[model samples]
Target: MTAITRLTVLIPEVEPAHWWQCARQNRSGAVIDRALRRHTDAVVRRLRMRS
Candidate 1:
């Protein structure tokens, strides 16, 4: 006698129009990412003495 195993996978149906749009859709923690980006940009601007 032998045993059989089965596997299943799920996929999304919607299609993205752009590469960046697709990447963002699959990402989490957008608020944190935006905050960190803003902080880094502010620091860079300050160091560069930009208004």
Candidate 2:
């Protein structure tokens, strides 16, 4: 089981449109969490390629 931490994110005034679309549809935490994980994974991959 994965442990969870409480986060306080201060998003910019103009947030990503898809994020709001998901929120409005009540997709909630799960979708956002996966999106973050995917983004993080991409960053990691880029860094690994450069090293």
lDDT of all the models against the reference? 0.40, 0.39
Model 2 earns a TM-score of 0.27
Report RMSD (Å) for each prediction in the order shown: 18.8, 13.9
Query: Compared with the true structure, what per-residue lDDT tens digits does model 1 show for residues 1-51?
Result: 899554322222344566566664543334445565666543211111111
TM-score list, all predictions: 0.30, 0.27
lDDT of 1 at 5: 54
Compare the candidates by TM-score and give the number of the best one. 1
Using lDDT as the measure, which candidate wins? 1
lDDT of 1: 0.40
Model 2 C-alpha lDDT versus the unseen true structure: 0.39
